[model samples]
Target: MILAAIWACWTSAALGQAVPNHADPSAREILPNPVPVPAIRFLTSADFPPFNFRDETGALVGFNIDLARRICEEVDVPCTVQAWPWEQAADALADNQGDALIAGLALSPENGERFDFSSIYLALPGRFVTQADAARGFDPSALTGARISVRRGSAHEEFLQRYLAHATLAPMDDEIAALEAVKAGEADAYFGDAMRASFWLNDNLACCSFAGEAYFRPELFGKGLAIAVPAGHDTVRHAIDWALVRLKEGGSLDELYLRWFPVGFY
Candidate 1:
């Protein structure tokens, strides 16, 4: 049943969160450093499970951890991670607090005003979490005027704003907080990435059933997520892109996708 619990995670197909004109996001693309650097500082959110999380001893590990280290290997840099809340990542990157972030963040326009983003990686759907009432039928519109929970800086928050206009929102630092918000009845529903919504449902609220199809708005939702760097750090930006291109060519991208998405989804 342990693995069954893990396997029960259900999610929607995908979303488009890519940035246009990524070849020169900031007019300066990075070139790889042939010589390896001794240390590089990286930023990530610890709350997103299977993608990134803290271990029992308080170490960060997950798919993004491995993916980021591989990127560092290709770019000839050593990385040290600083785990912070998801909401703080953009501000930290903008203020030069970290060299890069791998939090699977969307390339929102507001974030673009402050930082530079790389190319698209993976696009997944945003889903709704409802308790499966006979009358409501789990439609996003069914719960209008109800309180909903979302992560403070996610593209899904934008989704809620546009789709569930009648609903009031309660923003939290992480998806887990949003899950708790639903459990505690502070919010009527929880919204986030489909994979994340599945994880939240599994780890906490199994009684609730999810509903609806994937919705995507490329302009508002972003093209997809790529690693984000400070606006001025062109050297690092292009190097990461080059590494991703190689990863795509070398079949590493698909391999990583298979490794992380075993149940399989975009």
Candidate 2:
């Protein structure tokens, strides 16, 4: 429930950082060696669709599921993905009920203290969406005086205040209102989660398009999705991180993204 609430709070409203590529000279050393384990039990939830969910046949499927399988392959270990209620999943991980958690989980200070996290495998960046006709590149000068709609008291609002202080801001109650402001021409653009904006453009409203490159502010959005292992489980954490880097390097991660999100935010 905690994870679900966290996801909902973030998603009901709106809704990549530059990752270090394989070229990073220290990439080899940065990757951790996998620890020997009889089996890797992955705990997740079926509530979060596209990331983690069950199909009509009751099979676990989604980006997170695929990534878990890939992790097992990279580690050369057997893996079992089990769907449980979010609270129980967290508890299970803490109780050693599972070797790792593959849910698309965001990290928080409390959670950070409770569990170790892998390198981000997925990031949700803040983006600007505007009317299709008005879609333009992101340039400070171009949007110098533009009106950008954002949810009041949101990370996006704080980002705009701190970075784009020169632009006029229109605060709205929620993601829908902020987007509607742009659709109605009340605001020059809407700054919010790229996923939500994509959904709006692809379904609810087709009149708007993303205006710029995705913005990655960890404080604003998050560190993205990562594997959550029990506290001090450095081996598992590092193993997941290593596998994730490989996935990113081999283009497997991007392929998975494309498969799930045809209308990608990145």
Candidate 3:
């Protein structure tokens, strides 16, 4: 079955849950256009599915691509989006080949030295997926003695160790394996990237579904996803930030989120 059909099968209980909001609602300052650039150039990588990737016809498309266009439209500027190898994207931005990057670039201190980031637009939270029957009444914080499978040495595992210390940790080599442990009843639950798990639940696995609320520990999971401009490019950065806040206030950002993520992660 196609993704849309599969997603349609999701229980209304899950769909009714609130989607997480990243944009600050109070940041409603009217931004004065800083340094009017003729156009905005956006660079992205084509490998990160759902966020940025190529379709069967090989057209550059995905959430990030659409978001870049939206930002330009909101700023009332012409824009162009181009794909590059992940490794080359940062260099391309530094070389002035692009004015901004919409790819899921990690917002690290090291990266902060090289780029100025807009406010976080999305955050990938850690979530627990349990057998469909067991999902009801599931409380992640109370999983004492319950074995929870997670990617070995991942930030998710670290989060488990630090916060959900009551649960027994069953580390696996990769996300699929961790999820398989749960599907096969080797583990009581699986905790990992909510977005990745959502894809598996909607398109691949059917025995399990998300349990409880999404966990957001920015310190452990990194500071979520943001647009990046070369350091000192304050004009571009400010413009992007203004557009993003407007999108959130007008619910355009939420629409894009639901469109890309048919199976809501939160």
Best by TM-score: 3
lDDT by residue for model 2 over 75-143, one digit each (tens)? 777889999997678888988889898886569998888888876666677888888877755564577
lDDT per residue as tens, model 1, 27-128:
223456655434457799999877889889988987788778777776677777888889988788778888889897777777787778766566555666
Clashing pairs in 2: 15-196
Backbone N/Cα/C clashes per model: 9, 1, 0
Q: In terms of TM-score, which candidate is stronger, 2 or 3?
A: 3
Model 3, 1-266: lDDT tens per residue? 22231121222333464554565444457473835766899999999999899999999998899899998888889999999999999999999999999898899888888999987788777899999989999987689999999999999999899888888999999999999888899999999999899988886446888998777777777667899999998888878888888887676777788888888887
For this target, which candidate reaches the highest lDDT against the unseen true structure? 3
**What lDDT does model 2 reach?**
0.75
Stretches of candidate 1 off by over 4 Å are: 1-31, 35-39, 126-193, 197-216, 220-222
- In candidate 1, the residue pairs with backbone N, CA or C atoms under 3 Å apart (3 or more residues apart, or in different chains) clash, namely 15-124, 16-223, 17-222, 17-223, 17-224, 18-222, 18-223, 18-224, 30-238
Candidates 1 and 2 compared by TM-score, better number = 2
TM-score of 1: 0.57
Model 2 bad stretches (over 4 Å): 1-35, 138-140
Pick out the ten consecutive residues of candidate 1 with the lowest summed lDDT. Answer: 16-25
Report how far residue 93 has shifted in candidate 2, in Å. 0.8
